[model samples]
Target chain A: MAMSRAVLEGRAEDTDGRLLLLDPSDNVLVVRARIPAGETIRVGGGVPVPVPADLPLGHKIARRPIAAGEKIVKYGAPIGTATVAIDLGAHVHVHNVKSDYTPTYHLLGGEAGR
Target chain B: MTMRGWLRSDGRKGIRNTVVVGYLVECAHHVAREIALPFREEGVHVIGFPGCYPNAYAERMMERLCTHPNVGAVLLVSLGCESFDKRALERAVRATGRPVETIVIQGTGGTRKSIAAGRAFVAAQRAALDAAPTVPMDVSELVIGTVCGGSDGTSGISGNPAAGRAFDMLVEAGAACIFEETGELIGCEHIMAARAATPELGRELEASVAKAARYYATLGYGSFAAGNAEGGLSTIEEKSMGAYAKSGASPISGLIKPGDLPPRGGLYLLDVVPDGEVRWGFPNINDNAEIAELIACGSHAVLFVTGRGSVVGSAISPVVKICANPETYRRMEDDMDVDAGRIIEGRATLDEVGAEIRDLVIGLAAGGRTRSEELAHQEFVLTYKSFEPIGPACLPAA
Candidate 1:
């Protein structure tokens, strides 16, 4: 029910840049807009971070460096675990993180259809 | 606001008075479709079970669908040789005091002859349904269901949570609200169970998700689909959290399986995974199949949240589409009812979009059609499955 200051000011993009921090405890932030590789975007409190890959809208970005075998937190809960160590602002997705509950299926490079 | 509703014999009220034309098996699908073709624009819908073999789950689902409050009358089309018990289905429909007629392909001479008879029955029933009287209905008498498909990150933050807020509001107003896909709620079982009204119900809630985990594990596939991953979801637990938001923050009233109605006006979690074994390939093949199950649970309308975007509407109930991503909404504006993505963009708050959804449901009850209904998306799908009866802890009296 609490409104963010950026949202109240109608300047969410200015405050959080393209990455949205769902929970303060979350190590990953959701991409509000697509950020092509080699572009620099600000993170929490306008800390500049370089985009290593083309992060599409709705994709997740590492809020901080995550160690291998560590739980990847989002919405203040563990969504999955980092299969490999992930650096700050890197794209956090199927390739780097794997589900502890069930295998994540992808068309290009997963157990299904190949 | 009070709205006009079609009152059924069992005292349930419906926002629509549709004449459902159901084919008993895949063999009769064509004839049934041909019969309902001419009357498609006149509130006549086509629904069927494709399995030729008899399945108790399918039979119960068919009966519940035929007797759905939205259904005014039923015209059954049978292929004559399928193991499906057409007679028992007809008897169940008859017990509801609704006009029921059956046309068997073999008994009625041939395909052309059966279609003619079926059309004739539908024509008469449609006319009577047109003249059927509607009684005044309130929000308290309504039962609404929610499901999410093509989910992404925005779904958790925007569409799903907004829909969840609407569910909370509906539950507060004394209307029954159901949220399903325990298969998708894998990681959030403990969180969801804590909301249960009773401790026993909480255990049942956890057991349901555990069953889903086991079922999908056995099949070597989770509810997480390829499109889901493409839409930026990395794992089943992540998608489960997003889907779980559709349940809102209301106290979990009870747990019911497919075809089981919520006993009172509160929030209920639908345990959609089949019991005992993973016999039915997958719990739900697609979104429409889940929608059909929700309709069978007596949902007058279903709130469908999508991020990657889906264009399906159910045969028995109207689907209110809530688009989660702002980009997806721009690309598929005509197909969506609410742009829940506005919340993500800071154009609107969750409470604002939630109220919009609640108002839309009320408006639909007063005869306003959804974008899907306007586009003629009367999609329905049902497959084979099995279920055990709900225990006492599932629904304790208020």
Candidate 2:
């Protein structure tokens, strides 16, 4: 079998910043470590983009601009659809992306907008 | 290829020779626990159905568990008034050629009398089981199941995929591997459907996930728990992408319900969610509940991948904990068997971790105890649920 980590291993840093691209088709990068607001982060061999907000680890950040209601691709599959237009380096979370199978419920309050 | 194993008359082999003390109803749980308590040092475990009312699902699960390959004997504790088919269970155990005894609390006078009688029966059975003949077993004869719990952002990247690699190696060696929780596989149905061995099987795979999505939608909540978000997951579909990695790259051979066994050596998916309406609150109440379903389907061992760290093991089967987070593994190293998180930390590769997990499985089957087993983490929880019989298309070979 092909090396397992090679296909799915998340990246912490690659001389750019700690962002992981799970699949080549993915439009978002998983945060390997927490990033401070306004910090410039480079990912997927693309140009560096400045972070709009401080994001926790494991959360996602858009690698590039995405249109409103577009399917958000991660792991080479659609995890959810973008609720509104997402800009590069913007945090992609419940506020921006929502699950297509069922409503995504946030623990703090109500469900995300579908 | 041969390992020391208990050979049953029905032609099943067991890695561990265990005696299960089952309580037929809630009324008999106390006496059953008391009987198995002192023998905890031995391969004795307590299992029961809490409901006094008869349920077909419970009956089948209890029967399959009692006659599981790991069990060498069974002791049934009945309240004498419950509707459980104790006679049928006893008969089933007898057919498997294992020593079985029933102690009716009402007939035995009381709890004290029943406990005394049950203990003596256990002692006799234990002596017989020790003298039971053992035969050589092979890797191809084993059945393994995989499930991920307490998932974090690192799960999909590390532990789950490492487990998938191990699954691939096992399947290639002709072992029956099972991966479940269609509720968690929601958005990836289209991707998973393509991995089915046949076009019909692909349809069955997609339909199963679709059914789970609809059922969870009615419940007003996805299969995702709040802790999932705490660990970096944003939605059930995102968690699924990581969870789906546990299946590795094997072609799904079939789809099965709780008690259905795979016909041959290949990968299979256990449909944990029920067919019709949600009769019992949720498909799986907790992680161990899923482990129970895997056990009922005849899993000899379960590979549990956890990012946030779940320290649970099953009663009849051994659970090998694969930690996805390096930090979590550091805090709970004793509970874990393989450190897939090392891949995320750049200390090891996924193939290396997969090989480590594969070696661990072979070692456990050959009598090496896992950390969970050593710590006595025999967590078992089975709740009420309903399932219709599987169709011919479900298991084409069977």
Best by DockQ: 1
Model 2: residues >4 Å from true position, as ranges?
A1-17, A33-40, A44-57, A108-114
lDDT of 2 by residue, B139-253 (tens): 8888899999999788998899999989999999998999999999988898898988888889989989988988999899998877777677878999999999999998999
- List of chain B TM-scores, one per candidate: 0.99, 0.98
Q: For residues A2-108, could you state the per-residue lDDT of candidate 1 as single tens digits?
A: 21222234333544567777765778878887778788876545567776667777888777789999999987789999988987777788989899988988884
lDDT value, residue A111 of candidate 2: 27
lDDT of 2: 0.85
Return the top candidate by lDDT.
Answer: 1
C-alpha lDDT values of all predictions: 0.88, 0.85
- Cα lDDT tens digits for candidate 1, B50-168: 99988999999999999999999999998899999999999999999999998989999999999889888999999888998899999889999999998977788789889998998
Residue B227's C-alpha lDDT in candidate 2? 70
Per-prediction interface RMSD?
3.4, 3.4
Name the lDDT of candidate 1.
Answer: 0.88
Model 1, runs deviating above 4 Å: A1-15, A45-47, A109-114
